[model samples]
Target chain A: MTLSPTERSTIRRGAARARTDRADLHAILDAGLVCHLGVQIDGSPRVLPTAYGRDGDTLYAHGSTGARSLREAAEEPAVCVAVTLVDGIVYARSLFHHSVNYRSAVIHARARAVTDPDETWRALQVITDHLAPGSWEHARHPNRKELAATAVIAVDLGEASVKVRDGGAVDEPEDVEAATAWAGVLPLRWSWGEPEPAPDLPPGAEVPRHVRGRGVR
Target chain B: MTLSPTERSTIRRGAARARTDRADLHAILDAGLVCHLGVQIDGSPRVLPTAYGRDGDTLYAHGSTGARSLREAAEEPAVCVAVTLVDGIVYARSLFHHSVNYRSAVIHARARAVTDPDETWRALQVITDHLAPGSWEHARHPNRKELAATAVIAVDLGEASVKVRDGGAVDEPEDVEAATAWAGVLPLRWSWGEPEPAPDLPPGAEVPRHVRGRGVR
Candidate 1:
């Protein structure tokens, strides 16, 4: 649970409450395979949750071949990318003190647009496979038209902070002795269920073992 | 599940995908509440998740009286407040294309620091009750210094947006027949479990019915 300082935020509260070790950040990111991009467009902010993948210290995101917003994000450079996983709710004796124990990572940095067709195509594959292992090989690869319509943006791993809250609720010592109310944590969990194949598939298309063998914490 | 246009994001893809009605900007704010504030501090960006509540279209956040960051947030006119809920994961055949179904609201506006003692106390109650319903009445209210140390920041709900993705993955027609990879949704849920009492209690305090009741979706 202890992480080196570089993976930590400078603000004491921001760092203490939310710890982002490499393992912790990667686990949270890999579990859901999606992220929300906070963009301040013309001083107006917008949060766009989309599919994303981390390669080393760079996070990669791709948009539909013709998506204008993402294209603009690539052009803008400065943006905030946030990803979170809610582990549970902290229920305390006092209502004013309830909280959620969650794991999250936020990157505040400029992104560079990946314009090379080859790099974009490979990045797309890396992103796709990150979401589903063994997927790029199973599905048809995008053609030239698809490549032309897409935009890829990469945000560096620097200037990032990770925060996490886990375990039971922390209550005031006096509140512990007072017979007034209950205090504890209500755990939250995410699980992968049995795979359901597309209804219109050819009869012989059985689900792959890797696809069905999901990992849940 | 359809919500008024005001409840949805103007950018289309950013709107809530589930219970659009409950997904309305105000409704999401009114529901069991807390928000994460993202700010750029000391050359790094940090997102701090904390307790919050709403009055009309304005969102108020209250932090520990000794919290310097909250004080700084209050001193400023606008800050970024984001509330997000993950509903499920969209496991598609292609790895690069995996997505999540979620409901989220983001507000980027100047927050006027509320300095009136009475307003600060009221904001505390709203934040407290928002975390655990009916507990504020039973818990000890903040006294003078605690009140002084606390900071309350109210951000206007304008210049905001909500985005979401729901249901099963939308696969390509041809991929549906050949994907052989399974396709479906693994629903994500947030639930409150039975409460655990503080260990040193006088041994007779039972959890209140409302505190023990199941959370609403």
Candidate 2:
């Protein structure tokens, strides 16, 4: 399904980067580990970086119930959540054309607080597994006390848009021909280093396969 | 000088992670390559991931004048710019305590469009140097036409807050002791791979030293 771009979700600038395919939206969101949740608090804008997960067309975001933005989203969720993957830094012949190659998914939705306990449980599991692939089964699940402190908000992917900027820089014709400076892309890679175990952990514990495998991406 | 956290800038939630030093805010902002610019567009929230630069107590963001959010910011700069660096994933004994170790700086200010040509040049330079350390000197500088197409917004760092979460998981007493699950952190690192030259670049155009040095970070 192609995302239906409303007046709010429409890409006004750099229309070339805007994508319509819903699959592209999901792919960009899935590849990202964090999202910036945008909401208004007392007439002021606030953007907080948080972990998110996608379950089909719904995006799930969880935070402490005590969070002001979460509470505001629950009350009135005309919110924007953006996930961006910075792929590379493009160096152009002229500084004017220097840009970053990135894939960003922005969703405009009325995020409703997940009220059903079962759904909350499932949403938390999805969020956990999204961050750490096998952690939901490997680690201890959230108990009642933890559940009470958490608030999960869900936003439909109906009004979402994906924008991607790739390839090398686009310098002006004259600058490209006249300039002697180097022009290329410095691609950014997200890598994982050796895992550091908790100091309190008992001796002889091993890093699980799921934890080790997540490094490739 | 320390950041003056107004009512809007104060970190109400997770106050334990809130930082007071202005230098800390600078360090966090400097270490990041992109900032999530948040604003209310037609009374609905919107957050766009864009590159930003820090110059002492002021942050600079540039975009096309045609962007709706940039225009809104120009009119009333009550904007929230967020920069986050995710250091690692904290695996806890219980799902309740799972979190990401990160450093995030959120600035709340009225971002005014830089109309002064001299200031715009400097601001662009700061931005270019922040993204690509030596590009400003090595690459061709922007001509007048290119400068006219860009809109640079400057936000004072006076009303910003830094929040950092580090170290191990904070599990409940029982969960920490009773749980036999693997508990630690999976550290995330940003690594730069071999620089891929643009297809149009002539052969044997060597990668500059500045580009090579940036990889260490």
Model number with the top lDDT: 2
lDDT of each: 0.65, 0.87
lDDT of 2 by residue, B67-97 (tens): 7788787776488999999999998887778
In terms of DockQ, the best-performing candidate is: 2
CAPRI-style docking class of model 2 based on DockQ: high
Task: Please state the error at residue B168 of candidate 1 in Å.
Answer: 3.2
How far is B165's C-alpha from truth in model 2 (Å)? Answer: 0.7
Tell me the deviation in Å of residue B20 in model 2: 0.6
Stretches > 4 Å off in candidate 1 = A1-8, A14-21, A65-69, A95-97, A117-119, A193-197, A203-207, B1-9, B12-23, B30-34, B38-46, B65-78, B91-98, B177-181, B193-196
TM-score for candidate 2, residues paired by index: 0.97
- Model 2 stretches with alpha carbons more than 4 Å out: none
Enumerate residue pairs that collide in model 2. B77-B110, B77-B111
Q: Model 2 misses residue B143 by how many Å? A: 1.5
The per-residue C-alpha lDDT of model 2 at residue B95 equals 77
Query: Candidate 2: DockQ?
Result: 0.81
